[model samples]
Target: MSRERPIPSNGIVVLGASGMLGRAWRELLEELGINSRFLGRDECDITDAASIRRAIDGWPIVVNCAAYTDVDGAEAFEDEATRINGEAVAVLGAACIETGARLVHYSTDYVFNGQRDWAPATAPPYRTDEPRDPVNAYGRSKAVGESLLEPLIDSGKLDALIIRTSWVYAPWGKNFVLTIAKLASERDELTVVNDQYGRPTSALGLAETTLTLLENLVEPGIWHATDGGRCAWFDFATAIAEKTESGCVVKPCGSDQFPRPAKRPAFSVLDLSETEEVIGPMSPWEDRLDQVLIQAGLANKRRLRKARK
Candidate 1:
């Protein structure tokens, strides 16, 4: 389900320490007592080669979590997103190469178009070897980063791994779980898009699993990491509301009902075969969600209510 292993002796430096994923990494590293340094955007401007080089010079493992994560906003600021998710990655990769540091970078399932002519029942998960066919600007921007980094990895010029995950959530941060839980407490009814489906990855679990991968000495290339099982956004929302023990009624609706600038994939599930082969079966998404909610004390709502009475 969840795992942790010894990290490198030279220590790790985490970028994007201000973001949700970054904070998870920080927490995990601290728990493990691994010598680590976490840097936010203000401290480390990845777009600047000098800043990137300075950050990478001493660390043996470089974990990059920084990115322009706004999916809908990317439609309007594609260039800015590209500058961060794409161009900045190129610079960071170069710095890693120069410093001889192994890189661990995160990407999204959005890199795939999430459409197929085949029957939905039999459609296979997106393999690592699949071609890039993004449906939205955010996906395209991430695809650009993959394009720049894949060549380096294939050529054996850079020692790095790119992990593609979906619907990432953590105890702290602006994520689907917290959003739905909050709304369920305030509103009587909530509508979520039912057409979209993908696996959910717990940031805490992901951070630990990532360390486990490193402990196993996996190769430098693309890999998928998410909790086991798949579900639509509505299904996930319902699970969150239930976990929080809220009275909010969750309703399903098509994506068209709540339009946004970005065109999200109907199905963005990444193939976890390779990942599972390495780390064994992942914990089910519901189990992972429960663990996280409990950690955040959201699961204690009902207990607190009973205590109040």
Candidate 2:
């Protein structure tokens, strides 16, 4: 992000537009009747600067949802993760600068080490300016992008907006919600970790709120976006179980119960005060979850709630 105002014209180019979050952005743009063009990795390989330039040339704004998103895989494939999620961003940033386009990049909360593990009940949300101390290779890779771009932003050489979101799920694509929903449907019981705590985000709600931020001309800088409240992974999985009415007993257990290749933060909730100040409070993750479950035909229609504008 830079000091200059971040605004874009009607036409938008969404790289990695076939991903879950990308589809959300595409659907929102179509619903709003905005002109937006989407490109898959084959059409616009972000690793190549020329491809990025070609894809984003005429668009006033470039929303990049692309990244090496595998957290656990990063431990073994750190180099590949760094190349795609870390290095390619340098190319994207340069292309955006050359094309004179406003760049909107998505980041993750894993950039933090979640040192608040000792005090989950009293843990505070991580701020945008916090010193990054990632605990895993995936987080390290993402941190590489933030590190590379901050200097350019400080020098007033780039026009960009880095938005950080977490625990994303949608009606389509692979995600925790769908996995738990399907498992709950087939299994009588499930075990979820109760140690990790973070906010859940709906891809649709996130897309809409991002559009609202663009419309409101919020400051061009690092910002955090997510649902209204925070909860443990066990809580989230349990909620999905109840919503699906799969009659699955979701048992809570410590993180040690099931280890992962990636070491996730114990407290990764991002502070939303900055984002809320501009776009109003976010819709509850539960309400947003209901919308997605309904779309996936996993929730009862009676659980419907009003969607965000």
Candidate 3:
């Protein structure tokens, strides 16, 4: 268990506050009664060091939710992705170090190369201590970000928590769940990749877990967080279809059938034993999805309330 610490009341600054994860983090912090501030890209350009320093000057804690997350798009634009994901992390870590502020940064399972195809489904989750060998351009960029931020942490100039997650979705924003739900509603049938396996994490749920750590001040290092179970994209889409009251039949297909410029991990299901031990267990993806859809007015309110509670 992580020992609790006093959270400075200088007001938390959420970088990329307008993004999906950033919005969820802001909402969760408000619910927790924490003083929070959100800075959008226009307000603070992460790529610009001066902008980041100015925005983080007063905050005692910083949560970096900004990143170029277009996985496939990153392949052709690795430099741009590196500028945002890699260089920005280094800049934030340095600023946090100088300001004596703690930083919580979000990462992805793409950091791990999915070389093992026979990983168990719904088995032991990925731990923070696991080996990481990213396969694609996006993964490489994130890996570089993690590496660059390590020095500040080792020097104790900054306290950092790196969270590696997968399949994050939310009510508003361009996520797999909303995207699949909309596709299903518009089409009669959908073909989703069934071969690639991972956890379907709700941005809201991830936000809650993130708040729990911040409020408790979980040990500064790396952590793995996601919903309770794991499944393929098809299964995740199927759940979204059921929640949104869509009639589309979700057909399972291999990743090869839907090849893109970037290569996705075939088995990136993370083991969350350490994370769950420190905080309470994460809710299943289906339950979280149902609640999100209800919040979005796409699901039955009464049933959703019951399931969430």
Candidate 1 residue-wise lDDT at 140: 94
Q: What is the lDDT of residue 112 in candidate 2?
A: 95
Question: Which RMSD does model 1 reach against the true structure?
Answer: 3.1
lDDT of 1 at 203: 98
Candidate 2 per-residue lDDT, tens place, 1-309, comes to: 121333454678999998999999999888867889999899998888888888998898899999889999999999999988889998898888787887888889999999874577668899999989999999999999877776766777777888999999999999999999999999999999999999999999888877777767766778899998889999999999988889999999999989999999999999999988887789888888888999899987664432222
Among the numbered candidates, top lDDT falls to 1
| Poorest lDDT segment (10 consecutive residues) of candidate 3 | 117-126
Candidate 1 regions exceeding 4 Å error are: 1-5, 118-122, 301-309
Least well predicted 10-residue stretch by lDDT in candidate 1: 300-309
Q: Tell me how far candidate 3 lies from the true structure as C-alpha RMSD in angstroms.
A: 2.4
Regions of candidate 2 where Cα sits further than 4 Å from its true position: 1-9, 303-309
| lDDT tens readout by residue for model 1, 221-301 | 999898888888999999888768798999999999999999999888889999889889988898888888888988975
Candidate 2 lands at a TM-score of 0.94
Clashing pairs in 2: none
* TM-score, per-candidate, Cα-based: 0.95, 0.94, 0.93
